[model samples]
Target: MGARNKLKELRLPKRSEIERFVKQRPTCGMEMLSFLNCLKANQFQDSACVRERMALEECVREHQSSTGSGSGRKRKDTLMYHLKRLYYLQRR
Candidate 1:
């Protein structure tokens, strides 16, 4: 079968099941595979994740533009430092 048809054939649990799963985990305990499977099975096409990421980028841009001085440069440097730290930690 085609990928699209296969995705449509998959079955996801009801909303209550999702709520129960979240309540039980309440942290980074949820399984990524399960979540992706659910999305694929349901053929969900919402771009909320992309939208939220874009919003965060816009906020950062605005902050940088408003503080066009040494402070703005410092803010970017700090962010880059933290991101590098996170990347290294993830690699380990």
Candidate 2:
């Protein structure tokens, strides 16, 4: 009965629970696309896209600062983190 209770407590997390931790798109995604498009339109000339590049860089910097040095879910609860924790617990 004690072992059975332990097994019940060790049940795997639901698929939806894990899926909810999926990483979101970057805040600067639009800026990145704009920069890429600018480069492509100008025959891949870096000089032609300098303004777009600057805008993209600024967006990235702003995002990084807002997100505490760009850790971006590194220390947050994520799907892989959940799985690894369960794996180790089950192993023991």
lDDT of each: 0.50, 0.78
Per-residue lDDT of candidate 2, residues 1-92 (tens digit): 68756865786766677676565776888999999999889999999998999999999887777667676543354667777777676666
Error at 72, model 1, angstroms: 24
Query: Which runs of model 2 end up more than 4 angstroms from their true locations?
Result: 1-23, 70-92
- TM-score list, all predictions: 0.25, 0.52
Q: Among all windows of ten consecutive residues in candidate 2, which has the lowest summed lDDT? A: 71-80
Give per-residue CA lDDT, model 1, range 1-92, as digits (tens).
Answer: 47656555555555466556545333222343444555566576435344444555565566566667536454333544564555454444
Clashing pairs for predicted structure model 2, backbone only: none
lDDT of 2: 0.78
